[model samples]
Target: MTKTLALIAAAVLALPLAATAQSSTDAKPAAKAAAKPAAKPAPKKKPQVTRRAAKAVEEVTPIDTSTDVTLNEADLAVAGRVHTGKIQCELGADVTVTADESKPGYFTVSTKGAKYRMHPVESRTGAIRLEDPRAGAMWLQLGNKSMLMNQKQGLRLADDCQAPAQVAMSAELKLNPPKSLFEGADAPTSGPVKK
Candidate 1:
């Protein structure tokens, strides 16, 4: 029984070495098999794209500026608050500010002395070209509202002029603001309301 056990141990130890030796021998054939010839690539067929006729692009004519830019009063919606001395009114105009919206027929309005580029209907744009020939008045469009500030006050109203307009911020004999943002138009009244 002792001899049998010793024989079994020796066989177990030798079995590992024998298995390793056999693997080494087997690896040679595997290595040779790995040295296989390169496979040939398949040929690709050519695309059958046919050429079509060129498109006929016509030149777009420029808008006629010779005449007045037709402004649609129905489209213009004034949405802003206008205050003068003790007078105030809410201008509910829906203006646009989206890019790529070419609002033709829209005229830039100038009231009192302020100016801003009037937007077209459905444009959703906000631009105040507050430079008009009208004196004693200021026009500005904030967001979607067109505000017209005047220099007139009633009995009950002290003043409703907007902030000292930048254009006339300086120049003492400046116009009296109806609702002066700094103070009442009378705060820096150079003289009586000229008109």
Candidate 2:
């Protein structure tokens, strides 16, 4: 039994040596296969594409200045009332309004980097309103002040803008301080009151 056990141990140790020798021989064959150049693949036929002649494209007129807004007499009247030249506003900012000689009832409103072609728009409040529909900007001229607003941005670009006339009007309003609509409404009417 001891002799058998000794033989079994010897066979187990020899098994590892055999596996190492087999792996070395297998590696040499794999290395030789990698050293040999691989066969090149045949070129593939590409799909054919048909070419068409280019078609002439019509010139596209830009929509910014192309808008032909015909102003009525009322709108023109409002335009005439629009204060021209540079108007000072709050925060030391100024806006310039210039009437276009070529196009009546149209004015260019510019401040710093922005410039817009605006036209008078009728307002229910009796204020002179100029609008640039393309740029979504509006200039509102009131009795005592004017303002530039960006409708798209939902904020006023310039507020408390005053021209020469507006400055005087503003001072007058401060001095007189127009009476509110409800000032005398609460008081009894001059007519005989029913007891």
TM-score of 2: 0.60
- lDDT values for all models: 0.32, 0.70
* Residue-by-residue lDDT tens digits, candidate 2, 115-160: 9899987654356778887887878787777878776666568888
Clashes of each: 32, 0
Off by over 4 Å in 1: 36-195
For model 1, how does the per-residue alpha-carbon lDDT over 5-60 read when each residue is reduced to its tens digit? 45544553465588689989899787877789645544644421110000000001
Question: Between which residue pairs do clashes occur in model 2?
Answer: none
Evaluated at residue 73, the lDDT of candidate 2 is 90
- Misplaced by over 4 Å in model 2 are 1-66, 185-195
Query: RMSD of each candidate?
Result: 37.7, 37.3
**What is the C-alpha local distance difference test score of candidate 2?**
0.70
